[model samples]
Target: MTSVTPGVPERQAARPASMPVRCPSQVCDLDVLPDGVVVTDATGVVTAVNSRALAILGADRDAVLGADARVALPLQDLEGRSWWTCADPYGGLATRTRISETLLALPGDREVFLTATLGRERPRGPVVQVVVVLRAAAARRRAEQKTSALISTVAHELRSPLTSVKGFTSTLLRRWDRFSDDQKRLMLETIESDTDRITRLVAELLDVSRIDSGRLELRRQPVDLPRIVERHVEGLVASGHAADRFVLQVQEPLPEVWADPDRVEQVVANLMENALRHGAGVVTVAIAGSPGQDFLLVRVSDEGEGIPEESYPMVFTRFWHSTRRGGTGLGLYVVRGLVQAHGGTISVGRAPCGGAEFCFTLPAGAPEHVA
Candidate 1:
């Protein structure tokens, strides 16, 4: 996690400890607040500085009060330019102007940004005071930047190879006279493989985008749960996923539930893919109803290294991969989102199969949907 800079105070000549003080209003009690509070009169004069502010800035409160705010505490914009003369809500030129709606990068590795706001009214009141509020800016820009970069990189990297494969396949099919039957078969196989790779990449990208945008619309209809699980098993085994290496034990005549048929297949497929790649021994995919349950339960379990107990909560988070190989980190995230979109929940934990088990719920009745 990147650290955010805290607000800064100004460097000025120190005042003697015995400076006379006057309280402007009850709000002046803000100096006692835990946060490093600083107040400036409408004239830009430091009306009061809290003890916390003094400690944070390494200055005496008596020395800071009655001083020019810009002199006691300096501020800068993102470009490293001084913002002393920025916009002010009050109409006073000499008053130590209060800074509002601004971020002050302090001298430490703090992740929380300090935001100041006007606490005192001007003109009708003292026209010379302002209040500041400090809070952590939970903004996440790095992940957004990384995702954008990944989309661009993946598009460019895959386009050339896919184009070449498609071109050769088209040429061979069009000019069948130039190649023997064996040559044609080989080229076709290459074409099929390339097409499959492109398809997988496209599908993954689509799912990730839909999940990020929160626009993954589901078409829920009553469907047999067992049929969906069985279909995925048959397809995976026929597709050479070591059919005999793992056991897919599922309950028969599973409860019929409402869910998107196609999206459900994608969810099950992604889970099985995870199990096959990360798990050892038998990878079990099971579907059973919760005891006296109003929802249908589905679980995909693997006998691989089970996730550390500490990492269980993070498994469903976007781009959180346990291992460094053959994982997009988006599969479980999208899966959870899709399940929740259908008014359900998901959990990951130790499975009886000995690896990791992902269990999800599908509401037996219609539930509230989110956009």
Candidate 2:
């Protein structure tokens, strides 16, 4: 590896026990820093190196101590000069400067792109200390790339629903007198469905933001599990899905759940919607509770091709999609967030019918009073 600082002296002074040594300047403890830290004396000899710095250099603490700082990190500026040489023009002033896009050539021909910040402590003192902080260049680039991709995906997903709503409403408005009552109803329903799709997409996006920021909100209350599942199935039927398509099997005298009713409905609805769109055969919603159990179990299963076992781990990841069409890929992610927010757990597996089964548990609430 290329060495940036000058050769180490034969007899080096004893290194200080603490960083910044007795200087009046405030100094951050290198040991507590998350990033790699390398501290050097005025003559450019490695005096102190943190554990993280040793890991980055692939060397032991003893190997780097008393060595030339330049050889350990081997940082070179864009102009092909040692970083220390480039900073030498500053004449030992106490200043903090960042060297962007610097190349660090390590042993074994491995190179890492880094941005190094160079700071001096007590520049005018008899003994000046230089501190260098290093960060990976690829990390910042990856974050920028992810942000760009999310924006593009959101815009693309929003366009289709917006176009459908606009077209259906415009046609209904202009050709109102020519349509029959049935035709008018169908058009209005189609528009409403498209509008709902838009709303769902927007809500999923917002939920993702909230989940990422650890700010997801849940209004918890005593919820009747059977009633919520039945209502969701009824709504699906009213939306033109066959009533027979859904099968709800609930154990008698099931306990109430302590959860958010609206969020519970959303979880069931998203799962059933997934089944209808991607699964085949009967979609069954089953609820049961054991006498000694503290939680109620709800399972939504379908009789279609089940997800591969290896893919189960990624099913709940944000923006993950099995197919190109349908969904903003946030339904299951948001569902998991909402469920966990209420102190519940959700999982996916193969149903008895050889298809996807989503099972979740909710904490049981107090017994209901029959008045």
Candidate 3:
């Protein structure tokens, strides 16, 4: 399905023709389409059916080609009603020249996405032809499942923190003098921390939206990569992580790369958090310039059982889940989008210590004004 950007209205003009081509001959040999195509005559007889259509419906070519489409098609709704009888393209209103895409079940609990064009001789005239398009439902179904998962995950994750915030605030207001100063301070601090978590989750959702919609914007400035890494590590250590658990190294004479400072810091924090949460033992982060000409590099690695090489492709996909704890799985996706927006590339590999490794490079980009 095509996403129409918000605030952009579709043009209003004369009635538009369906599917760019209408005749039976034009769509007959349309095995060229990655999707299945089926055409029917005015009397509702199946005139042409492509190989894909046969494969999807599990119908024999000889049996399907000449049969009445109403009987030949094996699709049914959730109520087990025949699709043709319910839709009734031939008997439906002449103004309805097409069927919007709909999901219908086939035999054996399988499903297909179907859309059709009802061709007529003139405006509101008798239906002369019908062109049907079929597509496997797997990809669309997976996308819908992911969207549902995202909503469920975000709701579940937000509920805990929000409940804590409300509970703490209510307790404080109700028993202001009963608690000691230290106890009150701890309650307020907890509230603050939970608020930060909520803020971060909302920010991540917005970033994911922007990245997917091709609307992500960067405010490029010369970034001090080492300082950001140092500060992030310091915070982690202060937050009860062992100081020795992280080995940080920054090579001097780093190349000048203009990038969004906050985004770069977000990238660093996400990688470090991922390493800490998912991997075990020592975590190492190194920022350096390449030896020869210097491609600005940031490498983060951990000493844990390395990720399987086969899993690399899925690491950055939206809503991808792992056995590891925490995060909405948008961190690495946002990290990659931020890196690429700066004209950079990121890769996953295995570390020397037999653990997952992530390396990203910035191509020493200048500001847009200079470019």
- Candidate whose lDDT is highest: 3
* Model 3 TM-score, 2 decimals: 0.80
Cα RMSD (Å) per model?
8.5, 5.5, 8.5
TM-score of 1: 0.65
**What is the descending lDDT order?**
3, 2, 1
Report the backbone clash tally of model 3.
Answer: 0
Candidate-wise lDDT, in order: 0.67, 0.74, 0.83
TM-score of each: 0.65, 0.78, 0.80
lDDT score of residue 224 within candidate 3? 88
lDDT of 3 at 360: 95
Candidate 3 residue-wise lDDT at 247? 89
Model 1: weakest 10-residue lDDT segment is 3-12
Backbone clashes, candidate 2:
0
Per-residue lDDT tens digits of candidate 1, residues 315-340? 88765777745445667878888888
Model number with the top TM-score: 3
lDDT of 3 by residue, 1-371 (tens): 64331211222232335423346675465777788888876656677888889888888888987676766777788789888878877766869899999889888998899999988878898676788899999889888898898899899889999999999999999999999999999999999999999999999999988988999988888888888888999999999999999988888888888888999999989988888888989999988998863469999999988788888998888766556657787888899998888888999999999988999998775865967
